[model samples]
Target: MAGIGHITQDWEPVVIRKKAPNAAAKKDEKAVNAARRSGAEIETLKKSTAGTNKAASSSTSLNTRKLDEETENLSHDRVPTELKKAIMQARMDKKLTQSQLAQMINEKPQVIQEYESGKAIPNQQIITKLERTLGAKLRGKK
Candidate 1:
C-alpha cells in the first residue's frame, strides 16, 4: 500500500474487489434451444444384489438397537449445562459430526447426541475420552 495517494491513475486508498461476471447477458434463442439437451436413450439403474437392500435395511435396525440401548442406560443424573454447551461447541468447531466424534471417542453416536441434548450424563470414562478426543474439557476446573 502506498502512503501517498495518486489522483492521475484514479487510485483510491481502499481496495475494491470487482464482482465476478454473471450470466445476466441475454442468451440467443437459437443457442438456448441448442443447449437444451435431451435424448430418447433411457439409462436404467443396474440391478443391485439383494444384499444391497439388506445393508440399507440393517442400518435402521442398528439405529433402533442403539436407541433401545441408550434408553435402557439413560443417565439418571443431569449433566451440567455449561459442560454440555462446551462439548457441543468444541465438537462443532473441530468439524466432527456426532457419529464421527463418537467413533473417535469409541462410543456410540447416541451417546454424543445424548450428552449434547442433556438426555444422558456422561460417565467419567466417557468424559475423559471427550476431553482427549475433542481437545476440550468436559470436566470443570479443580
Candidate 2:
C-alpha cells in the first residue's frame, strides 16, 4: 500500500449572477401619465360648458279641494248619528263625564268624545265595552 501524503484532491467551480429589472414600476409610470392627460381634457370641457341653466317647468297644477271632496265621499263608514245621541244620553243619565266614562271602559277620553261627535270609526269591541258600562244596547238591531 501507498502512503496517505501522495493522494490527489478534486474541487467544484463557483458562479456569479445579476438581478432582473422590476416590471410593476414601468406599468405604474404609464398609468400616471395617462391620468394626467385625461385630467387636462376634463378641465377644458368643464370651462366650456359653464353657466348654461336648463330649468324644467311643468304646466299642470294639482286641485287639492277636489281631492279632499272625493276622499270624504268615499269614506262613508262612520258612527251613525243615532248611536252618538244614544251614547251622549246614556252618559248624561248616569251622571258621568266623558273622562269618567272613558275610565270605566279603560279607554282614552278622546275615544268617548269621538264617539259622541259621530267622528269615530265603529269598533265593535269599544261598542260592547260602552254597552256593558252604560247598561244599554248600543249596537245591532235596535
Candidate 3:
C-alpha cells in the first residue's frame, strides 16, 4: 500500500477573548461625564443671572418713570427747538457768523436765520452739514 497524508483540523472552536477596557476608553468616559456636568452648571447659572437682572432692571425703570421724558428732553428735546438751538450753538462756538455758516452750508444768511427762528425746517442734508460744522448732533425727527 502507498503512504497517505491526512490534513489536520481544529477540533475545538476558535475562541476570541474579550478585550479589557483600554485607558483611553476610561479617559473618554470621564471627559464626557465632566462635560455634561459643566454644561448643566452653566445653564443653571445663566437662568439665575437672567432672573435677577430682569427684576433689577424693571424695578429701576419703574422708579424712573417720571424722569424718562425729561431725560429724553435733555438728550435732544424738541423737533424744532433742539434743531434751532443746536445750530445756533454750533455756529457761535465756531465763532462763525450765520452768514459764514450759511456759506459753508451753501445757503443764504436769511435761510440760516429762518432755520434758527423755526420759521423753516432745514432738510436732512442741510442739517447733516450743520451737525458736522457744529460737532453736535442735530435733530432728525421726533
Candidate 4:
C-alpha cells in the first residue's frame, strides 16, 4: 500500500452578523412614535371633552327635567292592598304559614311576603295558582 497522503482542507470560520435596520424599519419607528404622540393628544382631547360635557350637562336641565317627567308618568302596577289583605286572610283561615302557602302555590316564600306587603307586580299565573290553592277569589270584580 502507498503511504497515505496528508489531506489539507481550508475551512472558513462561521460568523454570525446582526443586519442593520433598513429604511422600512426606520419608517416604521417614525410611524410608531407619531402614533404614540397622537394617541396621547387624543387622550387629552377625550378628557377635555368629558370635562366640557359635564359643564354642558350642568347648564342643560332639559335632560333632567325629561327624566323626572318620565319617572312621574311611569306608574308601577303593584299588588293591590285589598288583594293583599284577602291573601293574608285566606292564608290565615287555612291555617297555612307563608312558606306553606308559597309551597302549595309553587312559589318562593318571598313571593307570598311580597304579595302580603303589596310590593309584588301582579302576575296572572301566580294569581291563578294562589287562587287554585287557596280556593279564594283574589282577582276580578268581587
Alpha-carbon lDDT of model 3: 0.74
Give the per-residue Cα lDDT of candidate 1 at 90.
96
Q: What TM-score quantifies how close candidate 1 is to the native fold?
A: 0.45
Candidate 1 lDDT by residue in tens digits, 18-54: 7753553224455344445542243335656643677
Candidate 3 lDDT by residue in tens digits, 1-142 = 3566776777988889978657565457575577587784322224556546686677789668867656543433323877788888878889999899999888789888888998774577878888877788777556
Which is better, 1 or 3, measured by TM-score? 1
Query: Number of the top candidate by lDDT?
Result: 4
Best by the TM-score measure: 4
> Residue-wise lDDT of candidate 2 within 1-142, one digit each (tens)?
7565777777877777756436564347675577577783322224543465322222222455556557444565789988999999899999999999999999999999999998999998999999999999877586
Scored against the true structure, residue 120 in model 3 reaches a CA lDDT of: 78
Work out the TM-score per prediction: 0.45, 0.49, 0.41, 0.52
Rate residue 62 of model 3 by lDDT.
62
**Error at 138, model 1, angstroms:** 2.2
Q: Write the per-residue lDDT of candidate 4 for residues 1-142, one digit (tens) a residue.
A: 4688887899999999989657576457575587587783312224556535677676568878877778455667999888999999989999999999998877899999999999999998998998999998988685
lDDT of each: 0.78, 0.81, 0.74, 0.84
For residue 17, model 2's alpha carbon misses the true position, in angstroms, by 26
lDDT minimum window of 10 residues, candidate 1? 35-44
Q: 7, model 1: CA deviation in Å?
A: 99
